[model samples]
Target: MFMRGKCIGCGCCTSRCNADALLYTGEEMDADKVLDEVFKDILFYRKTGGMTLSGGEPLMQYDFSLKLLKGAKEKGVHTAIETSGYYPGKLYEIAKYTDLWLYDVKIFDESEHIKYTGVSNKLIMENLKYLNATGSEIILRCPIIPGINLTDEHFEKIAELSASVSSVKKVQFMPYHPLGTEKMKSLGREQKYENCEFLSRDAILPYLEKIKDKTDKILEIM
Candidate 1:
Protein backbone atom coordinates (compact mmCIF):
# COMPACT_ATOMS: atom_id res chain seq x y z
CA MET A 1 0.00 0.00 0.00
CA PHE A 2 1.21 3.53 -0.72
CA MET A 3 1.72 5.53 2.43
CA ARG A 4 0.25 9.05 2.34
CA GLY A 5 3.00 11.11 3.98
CA LYS A 6 5.78 9.25 2.23
CA CYS A 7 4.69 10.29 -1.27
CA ILE A 8 7.15 12.79 -2.81
CA GLY A 9 4.92 13.88 -5.72
CA CYS A 10 7.32 12.23 -8.18
CA GLY A 11 4.40 10.96 -10.36
CA CYS A 12 6.04 7.51 -10.50
CA CYS A 13 2.99 5.94 -8.87
CA THR A 14 0.71 7.35 -11.56
CA SER A 15 2.96 5.91 -14.28
CA ARG A 16 3.24 2.46 -12.70
CA CYS A 17 -0.51 1.93 -12.48
CA ASN A 18 -1.89 1.21 -15.98
CA ALA A 19 -5.41 1.92 -14.71
CA ASP A 20 -4.49 5.57 -14.04
CA ALA A 21 -5.84 4.94 -10.54
CA LEU A 22 -3.94 7.88 -9.06
CA LEU A 23 -5.80 10.99 -10.07
CA TYR A 24 -3.76 14.12 -10.60
CA THR A 25 -4.14 16.75 -7.91
CA GLY A 26 -3.63 19.46 -10.52
CA GLU A 27 -5.60 20.20 -13.67
CA GLU A 28 -4.23 18.73 -16.89
CA MET A 29 -3.50 21.08 -19.79
CA ASP A 30 -3.14 20.07 -23.42
CA ALA A 31 -0.46 21.42 -25.78
CA ASP A 32 -2.91 23.16 -28.10
CA LYS A 33 -4.74 24.80 -25.22
CA VAL A 34 -1.44 25.94 -23.74
CA LEU A 35 -0.29 27.40 -27.10
CA ASP A 36 -3.59 29.27 -27.48
CA GLU A 37 -3.11 30.80 -24.05
CA VAL A 38 0.50 31.65 -24.83
CA PHE A 39 -0.35 33.33 -28.14
CA LYS A 40 -2.85 35.58 -26.36
CA ASP A 41 0.03 37.81 -25.21
CA ILE A 42 1.82 38.01 -28.55
CA LEU A 43 2.46 41.72 -28.18
CA PHE A 44 4.05 41.21 -24.80
CA TYR A 45 6.24 38.41 -26.14
CA ARG A 46 7.15 40.43 -29.22
CA LYS A 47 8.13 43.45 -27.14
CA THR A 48 10.22 42.15 -24.25
CA GLY A 49 9.12 38.79 -22.92
CA GLY A 50 8.25 35.21 -23.91
CA MET A 51 6.81 31.98 -22.55
CA THR A 52 8.81 30.24 -19.82
CA LEU A 53 8.13 26.57 -19.00
CA SER A 54 8.50 26.06 -15.27
CA GLY A 55 7.37 23.24 -13.04
CA GLY A 56 7.04 20.59 -10.72
CA GLU A 57 9.79 19.70 -13.23
CA PRO A 58 8.58 20.47 -16.75
CA LEU A 59 10.97 17.89 -18.24
CA MET A 60 8.95 15.23 -16.42
CA GLN A 61 6.41 15.70 -19.22
CA TYR A 62 9.07 15.55 -21.91
CA ASP A 63 6.90 14.96 -24.98
CA PHE A 64 4.44 17.73 -24.17
CA SER A 65 7.27 20.10 -23.27
CA LEU A 66 9.09 19.44 -26.54
CA LYS A 67 5.90 19.92 -28.54
CA LEU A 68 5.03 23.11 -26.67
CA LEU A 69 8.49 24.56 -27.17
CA LYS A 70 8.56 23.63 -30.85
CA GLY A 71 5.13 25.16 -31.37
CA ALA A 72 6.19 28.34 -29.59
CA LYS A 73 9.35 28.58 -31.67
CA GLU A 74 7.35 28.10 -34.87
CA LYS A 75 5.20 31.06 -33.79
CA GLY A 76 8.39 33.11 -33.32
CA VAL A 77 7.96 33.14 -29.55
CA HIS A 78 11.13 33.11 -27.44
CA THR A 79 11.25 30.17 -25.07
CA ALA A 80 12.79 29.61 -21.66
CA ILE A 81 12.72 26.79 -19.09
CA GLU A 82 13.07 26.94 -15.32
CA THR A 83 14.35 23.51 -14.34
CA SER A 84 16.04 21.56 -11.55
CA GLY A 85 18.14 19.63 -14.17
CA TYR A 86 17.12 16.28 -12.62
CA TYR A 87 15.84 14.63 -15.79
CA PRO A 88 17.90 12.13 -17.75
CA GLY A 89 19.36 12.53 -21.26
CA LYS A 90 16.55 14.69 -22.69
CA LEU A 91 17.97 18.17 -22.03
CA TYR A 92 19.99 18.20 -25.24
CA GLU A 93 16.86 17.55 -27.26
CA ILE A 94 15.01 20.36 -25.51
CA ALA A 95 17.97 22.76 -25.72
CA LYS A 96 17.49 23.13 -29.46
CA TYR A 97 14.09 24.75 -28.90
CA THR A 98 15.03 26.85 -25.88
CA ASP A 99 16.14 30.49 -25.87
CA LEU A 100 17.11 30.92 -22.23
CA TRP A 101 17.54 28.34 -19.48
CA LEU A 102 16.85 29.42 -15.90
CA TYR A 103 18.56 26.45 -14.26
CA ASP A 104 18.39 25.85 -10.52
CA VAL A 105 21.62 25.02 -8.68
CA LYS A 106 20.70 24.15 -5.16
CA ILE A 107 23.18 22.78 -2.57
CA PHE A 108 26.59 22.25 -4.22
CA ASP A 109 27.61 19.30 -2.11
CA GLU A 110 26.39 15.90 -3.34
CA SER A 111 25.39 14.37 0.02
CA GLU A 112 23.60 17.50 1.26
CA HIS A 113 21.63 17.64 -2.00
CA ILE A 114 20.45 14.02 -1.59
CA LYS A 115 19.62 14.66 2.07
CA TYR A 116 17.44 17.66 1.25
CA THR A 117 15.96 16.86 -2.18
CA GLY A 118 16.08 13.02 -2.01
CA VAL A 119 18.17 12.98 -5.21
CA SER A 120 21.85 13.05 -5.97
CA ASN A 121 23.38 16.12 -7.66
CA LYS A 122 25.37 14.02 -10.11
CA LEU A 123 22.76 14.08 -12.84
CA ILE A 124 22.04 17.75 -12.24
CA MET A 125 25.70 18.72 -12.55
CA GLU A 126 26.22 16.53 -15.58
CA ASN A 127 23.22 18.06 -17.34
CA LEU A 128 24.51 21.52 -16.59
CA LYS A 129 27.88 20.72 -18.08
CA TYR A 130 26.26 19.33 -21.18
CA LEU A 131 24.06 22.40 -21.58
CA ASN A 132 27.03 24.70 -21.08
CA ALA A 133 28.99 22.87 -23.75
CA THR A 134 26.12 23.42 -26.19
CA GLY A 135 26.54 27.20 -25.80
CA SER A 136 22.97 27.62 -24.63
CA GLU A 137 22.16 30.89 -22.86
CA ILE A 138 21.66 30.22 -19.16
CA ILE A 139 20.84 31.91 -15.88
CA LEU A 140 21.94 30.03 -12.79
CA ARG A 141 19.33 30.34 -10.02
CA CYS A 142 20.14 29.47 -6.40
CA PRO A 143 17.66 29.71 -3.54
CA ILE A 144 19.19 31.20 -0.41
CA ILE A 145 17.61 29.31 2.46
CA PRO A 146 18.74 30.31 5.94
CA GLY A 147 20.71 27.62 7.80
CA ILE A 148 20.41 25.44 4.75
CA ASN A 149 22.34 26.61 1.67
CA LEU A 150 23.04 30.18 2.70
CA THR A 151 26.79 30.11 2.97
CA ASP A 152 29.86 31.76 1.43
CA GLU A 153 31.07 28.43 0.06
CA HIS A 154 27.79 27.88 -1.75
CA PHE A 155 28.00 31.33 -3.37
CA GLU A 156 31.61 30.76 -4.34
CA LYS A 157 30.79 27.44 -5.89
CA ILE A 158 27.96 29.01 -7.89
CA ALA A 159 30.24 31.80 -9.10
CA GLU A 160 32.94 29.33 -10.01
CA LEU A 161 30.49 27.22 -11.94
CA SER A 162 28.99 30.20 -13.74
CA ALA A 163 32.42 31.58 -14.57
CA SER A 164 33.37 28.30 -16.16
CA VAL A 165 30.30 28.36 -18.38
CA SER A 166 30.73 30.94 -21.13
CA SER A 167 27.06 30.96 -21.95
CA VAL A 168 25.89 31.94 -18.46
CA LYS A 169 24.37 35.40 -18.64
CA LYS A 170 23.33 35.81 -15.03
CA VAL A 171 23.39 34.28 -11.56
CA GLN A 172 20.17 34.84 -9.59
CA PHE A 173 20.39 34.48 -5.81
CA MET A 174 16.79 33.82 -4.80
CA PRO A 175 15.93 34.49 -1.18
CA TYR A 176 13.88 31.79 0.53
CA HIS A 177 10.33 32.54 1.64
CA PRO A 178 7.63 30.47 3.34
CA LEU A 179 5.10 31.28 0.61
CA GLY A 180 4.33 27.58 0.09
CA THR A 181 3.87 26.56 3.72
CA GLU A 182 0.11 27.12 3.61
CA LYS A 183 -0.15 25.12 0.40
CA MET A 184 1.72 22.23 2.02
CA LYS A 185 -0.62 22.37 4.99
CA SER A 186 -3.64 22.35 2.67
CA LEU A 187 -2.25 19.21 1.01
CA GLY A 188 -2.06 17.48 4.43
CA ARG A 189 1.72 17.23 4.17
CA GLU A 190 4.12 18.01 7.01
CA GLN A 191 6.24 21.14 6.60
CA LYS A 192 9.81 19.94 6.23
CA TYR A 193 11.48 23.28 6.82
CA GLU A 194 9.08 24.52 9.49
CA ASN A 195 9.79 27.88 11.07
CA CYS A 196 12.68 28.54 8.74
CA GLU A 197 12.99 32.30 8.62
CA PHE A 198 12.93 34.02 5.28
CA LEU A 199 16.33 35.22 4.23
CA SER A 200 16.33 38.90 3.42
CA ARG A 201 18.21 40.56 0.53
CA ASP A 202 20.38 42.25 3.11
CA ALA A 203 21.30 38.86 4.55
CA ILE A 204 22.27 37.55 1.11
CA LEU A 205 24.34 40.58 0.07
CA PRO A 206 27.48 39.45 1.87
CA TYR A 207 27.62 36.16 0.05
CA LEU A 208 27.02 37.98 -3.23
CA GLU A 209 29.89 40.30 -2.44
CA LYS A 210 32.20 37.34 -1.90
CA ILE A 211 31.58 35.96 -5.37
CA LYS A 212 30.83 39.10 -7.37
CA ASP A 213 34.36 39.43 -8.70
CA LYS A 214 34.68 35.75 -9.48
CA THR A 215 32.31 35.81 -12.44
CA ASP A 216 31.59 38.37 -15.16
CA LYS A 217 27.93 37.36 -15.34
CA ILE A 218 25.30 39.63 -13.81
CA LEU A 219 24.63 38.72 -10.14
CA GLU A 220 21.08 39.48 -9.11
CA ILE A 221 19.67 38.96 -5.62
CA MET A 222 16.04 38.39 -6.40
Candidate 2:
Protein backbone atom coordinates (compact mmCIF):
# COMPACT_ATOMS: atom_id res chain seq x y z
CA MET A 1 0.00 0.00 0.00
CA PHE A 2 1.08 3.61 -0.67
CA MET A 3 0.28 6.68 1.37
CA ARG A 4 -0.17 10.01 -0.37
CA GLY A 5 -0.37 13.20 1.66
CA LYS A 6 1.68 16.13 2.88
CA CYS A 7 4.43 14.37 4.85
CA ILE A 8 6.40 17.43 6.05
CA GLY A 9 9.43 15.15 5.59
CA CYS A 10 9.69 14.72 9.37
CA GLY A 11 10.57 11.01 8.95
CA CYS A 12 8.35 9.95 11.88
CA CYS A 13 6.45 7.41 9.78
CA THR A 14 9.69 5.96 8.41
CA SER A 15 11.01 5.37 11.90
CA ARG A 16 7.82 3.94 13.43
CA CYS A 17 6.49 1.82 10.56
CA ASN A 18 7.36 -1.88 10.68
CA ALA A 19 7.11 -2.08 6.90
CA ASP A 20 9.84 -0.31 4.89
CA ALA A 21 7.50 1.69 2.65
CA LEU A 22 7.50 5.37 3.53
CA LEU A 23 9.27 7.78 1.24
CA TYR A 24 10.04 11.44 1.68
CA THR A 25 7.39 13.73 0.18
CA GLY A 26 9.66 16.68 -0.45
CA GLU A 27 8.65 20.05 0.98
CA GLU A 28 8.55 23.25 -1.00
CA MET A 29 7.27 26.81 -0.89
CA ASP A 30 7.05 29.64 -3.40
CA ALA A 31 10.04 31.89 -2.81
CA ASP A 32 8.21 35.02 -4.01
CA LYS A 33 5.27 34.42 -1.69
CA VAL A 34 7.56 33.79 1.27
CA LEU A 35 9.48 37.02 0.65
CA ASP A 36 6.20 38.87 0.21
CA GLU A 37 5.14 37.81 3.71
CA VAL A 38 8.55 38.63 5.14
CA PHE A 39 8.47 42.10 3.57
CA LYS A 40 5.00 42.82 5.00
CA ASP A 41 6.52 43.26 8.45
CA ILE A 42 9.37 45.43 7.19
CA LEU A 43 8.28 48.37 9.33
CA PHE A 44 8.22 46.33 12.58
CA TYR A 45 11.46 44.63 11.63
CA ARG A 46 13.14 47.98 11.12
CA LYS A 47 12.15 49.01 14.61
CA THR A 48 13.23 45.92 16.53
CA GLY A 49 13.39 42.52 14.82
CA GLY A 50 14.51 41.31 11.40
CA MET A 51 14.18 38.39 9.03
CA THR A 52 15.40 35.16 10.67
CA LEU A 53 15.61 31.78 8.96
CA SER A 54 15.29 29.03 11.58
CA GLY A 55 14.34 25.41 11.41
CA GLY A 56 14.38 21.78 12.28
CA GLU A 57 17.67 22.74 10.64
CA PRO A 58 17.57 25.49 8.02
CA LEU A 59 20.74 24.34 6.33
CA MET A 60 19.01 21.03 5.72
CA GLN A 61 17.22 22.96 2.99
CA TYR A 62 20.29 24.86 1.99
CA ASP A 63 19.23 26.24 -1.39
CA PHE A 64 15.90 27.60 -0.22
CA SER A 65 17.46 29.14 2.89
CA LEU A 66 20.21 30.74 0.83
CA LYS A 67 17.73 32.26 -1.60
CA LEU A 68 15.55 33.48 1.26
CA LEU A 69 18.42 35.25 2.94
CA LYS A 70 19.69 36.65 -0.31
CA GLY A 71 16.27 38.03 -1.15
CA ALA A 72 15.92 39.60 2.32
CA LYS A 73 19.34 41.24 2.01
CA GLU A 74 18.55 42.54 -1.47
CA LYS A 75 15.45 44.21 -0.07
CA GLY A 76 17.67 46.09 2.39
CA VAL A 77 16.35 44.06 5.32
CA HIS A 78 18.55 42.62 8.04
CA THR A 79 18.75 38.83 8.04
CA ALA A 80 19.62 36.31 10.73
CA ILE A 81 19.61 32.53 11.11
CA GLU A 82 19.23 30.17 14.06
CA THR A 83 21.24 27.04 13.23
CA SER A 84 22.77 23.98 14.90
CA GLY A 85 25.97 24.58 12.85
CA TYR A 86 25.86 21.00 11.62
CA TYR A 87 26.70 21.66 7.97
CA PRO A 88 30.02 23.42 7.78
CA GLY A 89 30.25 23.53 3.97
CA LYS A 90 26.75 24.90 3.47
CA LEU A 91 27.15 27.33 6.39
CA TYR A 92 30.15 29.10 4.84
CA GLU A 93 28.00 30.21 1.90
CA ILE A 94 24.92 31.01 3.99
CA ALA A 95 26.98 33.05 6.46
CA LYS A 96 27.79 35.53 3.73
CA TYR A 97 24.13 36.58 3.42
CA THR A 98 23.31 36.50 7.11
CA ASP A 99 23.60 39.58 9.33
CA LEU A 100 23.32 37.82 12.70
CA TRP A 101 23.53 34.19 13.81
CA LEU A 102 21.70 32.56 16.70
CA TYR A 103 23.90 29.48 17.03
CA ASP A 104 23.07 26.64 19.43
CA VAL A 105 25.77 24.87 21.45
CA LYS A 106 24.07 22.14 23.45
CA ILE A 107 27.09 20.36 24.98
CA PHE A 108 30.84 20.45 24.55
CA ASP A 109 31.67 16.85 25.33
CA GLU A 110 31.94 14.67 22.22
CA SER A 111 30.36 11.46 23.57
CA GLU A 112 27.73 13.20 25.70
CA HIS A 113 26.71 15.44 22.79
CA ILE A 114 26.20 12.39 20.58
CA LYS A 115 24.33 10.59 23.35
CA TYR A 116 21.82 13.38 23.81
CA THR A 117 21.45 14.86 20.30
CA GLY A 118 22.21 11.72 18.29
CA VAL A 119 24.93 13.63 16.43
CA SER A 120 28.59 14.34 16.97
CA ASN A 121 29.78 17.76 18.07
CA LYS A 122 32.73 17.64 15.69
CA LEU A 123 30.84 19.20 12.77
CA ILE A 124 29.13 21.73 15.02
CA MET A 125 32.41 22.85 16.57
CA GLU A 126 34.14 23.02 13.21
CA ASN A 127 31.37 25.20 11.74
CA LEU A 128 31.57 27.53 14.75
CA LYS A 129 35.30 27.94 14.22
CA TYR A 130 34.69 28.55 10.53
CA LEU A 131 32.16 31.28 11.41
CA ASN A 132 34.62 32.87 13.83
CA ALA A 133 37.40 32.82 11.25
CA THR A 134 35.09 34.46 8.72
CA GLY A 135 34.02 37.15 11.22
CA SER A 136 30.36 36.21 11.10
CA GLU A 137 28.37 37.88 13.90
CA ILE A 138 26.99 35.23 16.24
CA ILE A 139 25.14 34.80 19.51
CA LEU A 140 25.64 31.48 21.28
CA ARG A 141 22.37 30.03 22.57
CA CYS A 142 22.66 27.17 25.07
CA PRO A 143 19.67 25.42 26.60
CA ILE A 144 20.17 24.58 30.29
CA ILE A 145 18.19 21.39 30.73
CA PRO A 146 18.12 20.02 34.26
CA GLY A 147 19.12 16.36 34.72
CA ILE A 148 20.66 16.43 31.26
CA ASN A 149 23.09 19.22 30.44
CA LEU A 150 22.74 21.60 33.35
CA THR A 151 26.22 21.27 34.77
CA ASP A 152 29.14 23.54 35.78
CA GLU A 153 31.33 21.91 33.14
CA HIS A 154 28.83 22.77 30.38
CA PHE A 155 28.76 26.44 31.32
CA GLU A 156 32.52 26.60 31.66
CA LYS A 157 32.99 25.07 28.22
CA ILE A 158 30.51 27.51 26.72
CA ALA A 159 32.32 30.43 28.35
CA GLU A 160 35.67 29.24 27.08
CA LEU A 161 34.35 28.77 23.53
CA SER A 162 32.55 32.12 23.57
CA ALA A 163 35.65 33.93 24.77
CA SER A 164 37.80 32.31 22.14
CA VAL A 165 35.46 33.25 19.28
CA SER A 166 35.89 36.85 18.17
CA SER A 167 32.58 36.79 16.28
CA VAL A 168 30.40 35.85 19.25
CA LYS A 169 28.46 38.92 20.45
CA LYS A 170 26.54 37.42 23.37
CA VAL A 171 25.86 34.21 25.25
CA GLN A 172 22.22 33.37 25.93
CA PHE A 173 21.47 30.64 28.47
CA MET A 174 18.00 29.34 27.65
CA PRO A 175 16.14 27.48 30.39
CA TYR A 176 14.53 24.32 29.10
CA HIS A 177 10.81 23.72 29.40
CA PRO A 178 8.62 20.77 28.37
CA LEU A 179 6.28 22.89 26.28
CA GLY A 180 6.80 20.74 23.17
CA THR A 181 6.03 17.39 24.80
CA GLU A 182 2.44 17.27 23.64
CA LYS A 183 3.42 18.37 20.13
CA MET A 184 6.03 15.64 19.90
CA LYS A 185 3.47 13.03 20.95
CA SER A 186 0.98 14.36 18.42
CA LEU A 187 3.60 13.81 15.72
CA GLY A 188 4.05 10.15 16.75
CA ARG A 189 7.38 10.79 18.45
CA GLU A 190 8.44 10.07 21.99
CA GLN A 191 9.07 12.94 24.34
CA LYS A 192 12.38 12.24 26.01
CA TYR A 193 12.15 15.29 28.27
CA GLU A 194 8.59 14.82 29.52
CA ASN A 195 9.59 14.61 33.17
CA CYS A 196 12.72 16.71 32.91
CA GLU A 197 13.11 19.51 35.45
CA PHE A 198 12.74 23.08 34.25
CA LEU A 199 15.50 25.40 35.37
CA SER A 200 14.57 28.95 36.30
CA ARG A 201 16.90 31.92 36.16
CA ASP A 202 17.83 31.41 39.79
CA ALA A 203 18.56 27.73 39.17
CA ILE A 204 20.98 28.66 36.39
CA LEU A 205 22.69 31.40 38.38
CA PRO A 206 25.20 29.06 40.03
CA TYR A 207 26.31 27.72 36.64
CA LEU A 208 26.59 31.27 35.32
CA GLU A 209 28.81 32.25 38.21
CA LYS A 210 31.32 29.60 37.24
CA ILE A 211 31.86 31.23 33.85
CA LYS A 212 31.34 34.88 34.77
CA ASP A 213 34.98 35.88 34.65
CA LYS A 214 35.92 33.53 31.87
CA THR A 215 34.34 35.52 29.07
CA ASP A 216 33.74 39.24 28.71
CA LYS A 217 30.81 38.59 26.37
CA ILE A 218 27.35 39.58 27.58
CA LEU A 219 25.61 36.68 29.34
CA GLU A 220 21.88 36.60 29.91
CA ILE A 221 19.33 34.05 31.08
CA MET A 222 16.44 33.81 28.73
Best by lDDT: 1
Assess candidate 1 and give its TM-score to the true structure: 0.86
Query: RMSD of model 1, in Å?
Result: 5.8
Q: Can you write out model 2's per-residue Cα lDDT over 1-222, one digit (the tens) per residue?
A: 333345566778787777877555655668777999899989888766889888788888899888999999888888889998888475667788998889999988899888888899999988888888778799999988998888887888889999999999999989998888887876667677888966789999888888899998999999
The positional error of residue 40 in candidate 2, measured at the CA in angstroms, is 1.5
What RMSD does model 2 have? Answer: 6.0
Question: Model 1: per-residue lDDT, tens digit, 1-222?
Answer: 556678788876786888987766765789999999999998889867999999888899999999999999999999999999998765778899999899999998899998888899999988988898887799999988888888788888998998998889998989999999898986787787777887789998888888889999999989
Residue 29 in candidate 1, Cα distance off native in Å: 2.9
Model 2 residue 158 CA deviation (Å) reads: 0.8
TM-score of each: 0.86, 0.85
Candidate 2: residue 114 Cα off by (Å): 1.1
Candidate 2 residues lying further than 4 Å off, grouped into runs, are 1-28
